[model samples]
Target chain A: MRKGIPNDPGRRDRLRAVALEFIAERGLRRFTVRGVAERAGVSPGSITYYFTDTDELIMSAFELLTEHAEPNFNVRLRAAGTRDEAIEVLIDYVIDPDDASQQEVRAVRELYSLGSRDPKAAALVRDRLEANARTALMLHFTEPCAHALDALIEGLWTQRSWNDEPLDPGMVRTAIHGLVTAFDSLEGTSA
Target chain B: MRKGIPNDPGRRDRLRAVALEFIAERGLRRFTVRGVAERAGVSPGSITYYFTDTDELIMSAFELLTEHAEPNFNVRLRAAGTRDEAIEVLIDYVIDPDDASQQEVRAVRELYSLGSRDPKAAALVRDRLEANARTALMLHFTEPCAHALDALIEGLWTQRSWNDEPLDPGMVRTAIHGLVTAFDSLEGTSA
Candidate 1:
């Protein structure tokens, strides 16, 4: 372990963070171990010694991203005791992401674009989707409604990411509220 | 003027179509006039005659994409006589896109990703967003509801594009209904 270049745990973590940032800055297809090594000011060999392959490297970066997000999700979601609060949680965590960076959302979207072609990347996206749906269900949303919320979060995120301006919270609240009401009506009819 | 290798209007249209397909297949960062020429079986000089610069080529491709989409939107939207019919049109045209191919969606997303850094691209995206919202409003959705519908369409498109399986139409209907209901209640409250 030579300062920031070798197989230290901290160095390994730093490489993963750098890899994700690189993908976020430049699109996923531009991601290369050598590129990440250059950005991190370490030799390619030093980085490869820790990651071995680019796929492993990208996967690790994704793991780190989820690991960082998981706790934030848990804390906020755990605090929500009502449907209204649950909507706030979904908006903050997913659509608007007041606590998350645009880079993080971009990185995840690049991974999602990859999912259209790569099976492993697809599995990760599916896992995230399932987890989101499960989160909504835990908040007492019906199955279809939970998926709807998840989809809305994803759709809004895309819209928000592309535009330079922040979405009005008032509008986001109304949209989410609309979805909930629509589903509530459906549930009422089916029941 | 020589078959498919000159400044002919037919060849120009073909080049634009090829450029969009190339971006959809290989992503926007990898797009090159030469690459599109190769894909179109034309020479780079021939392409330059129609589009002197890559920016023009890309913008032209974006224009062609909209030209193709606009008629579909107009025809379908014009036929929708009721709220439920409007929902069905939206689902078919935006969410599930029964008539549109996945390639079209991917190409649009590539342009949207480009919007984050490029001002021209950003304008195009904003235009598309505005147009979608306008369509929703014309369906008698209130202002906030129209925006919400646009966001849901965008969000659902993102979800549907990334996944291999088609989203269940029944589930999609429920989600859209939910948002509309929520907004309807708000409108009623205000009235």
Candidate 2:
């Protein structure tokens, strides 16, 4: 068991924020409870008190980062009234290096890596993806189509991680447009 | 240093074969070199002699599994009667479970996890992907399209990893078809 901090809500947020920054900078493999605590100007006990384990801390930190980014997505989606506009926003988000924080990208990569080997971690990612898709305005397609869209988006991110070349916004738009058109055409047909 | 097992090229093959089986049966996180050696009926020294480290062993074993399942993609491309046939083969190969071993999938998941945090490991995967694309029929596309296809494939694989449903052959085929059609259209426009 670890000792508790003063239990300020701000303190917990600050700690998690610092942790997220560290994860993005150092990569998740190198993140440690002690290191996060030190950076946050808190005791190690405070970290353990807020999060029971390393995985818990990592997961929470990830959740925080993603949740923070989610609003931006929502703002974009809401601003786009048509399907094409929505896709354009999505493609822009995906390929625009300036739109994404390096830390956030690194954190997502870490989550993906952890998810591959751990069922619980994988479930976390799956749940988030499903939840995001459900909330997404792009859920106008059938169940299979929606799921396939998810696959395409996830696949795009995986590919993005490996390459150093700047992703072309136009190519992304074309790919998403192609996918949407294909699914729309296949609506009545058995998938 | 680890001792070599003499008089048998089969020994190395057997060890890798068994290693793949073990990985499929048990996730890579739980797999060990000793366990692979034992399953192969070889000594630990033999496993070490062939693979200096677990990462090397895992990577090589995966490379072997991929080669074993699919015809040399590059060779197929060169011998292809038409560009369509080559693209079809590539599509068929990606989604065809018959040609892809469970071990190969596991190895990929493992590599993805490592690549998330390790730049060097990520570079290897990126290089492999670029090499595969270079050797394929996509050289005709503008450099951006060629790279976009790589991202699309990577995203597809990553999505497949997190998906809860069993692999759908038809869906895979549809995705490949869609991708090819989109690329073909790009060619038409460019021409």
Best by DockQ: 1
Quote the true-contact fraction of every model.
Answer: 0.50, 0.39
Model 2 Cα lDDT, one tens digit per residue, A94-188: 77655355456666666665666678767767777445654674545555455555666665666667777766676776667666666666775
Q: What is the lDDT of residue B167 in candidate 1?
A: 79
Model 1 stretches astray by more than 4 angstroms: A1-7, A29-32, A52-56, A69-71, A91-99, A129-133, B1-6, B53-56, B94-96, B129-133, B136-139
Q: What tens digits encode model 2's per-residue C-alpha lDDT throughout B56-109? A: 776666656455532455566666777568666656555654424434555565
Best-performing candidate as measured by lDDT = 1
- lDDT of every predicted structure (CA atoms): 0.73, 0.65
Instruction: Report the lDDT of model 2 for residue B73.
Output: 53
Off by over 4 Å in 2: A1-6, A69-71, A137-148, A188-191, B1-80, B87-91, B98-102, B113-119, B137-149, B167-171
Candidate 1 lDDT over A10-51, as tens digits, reads: 888999999988877776656789999999999998887888
lDDT of 2 at B189: 89
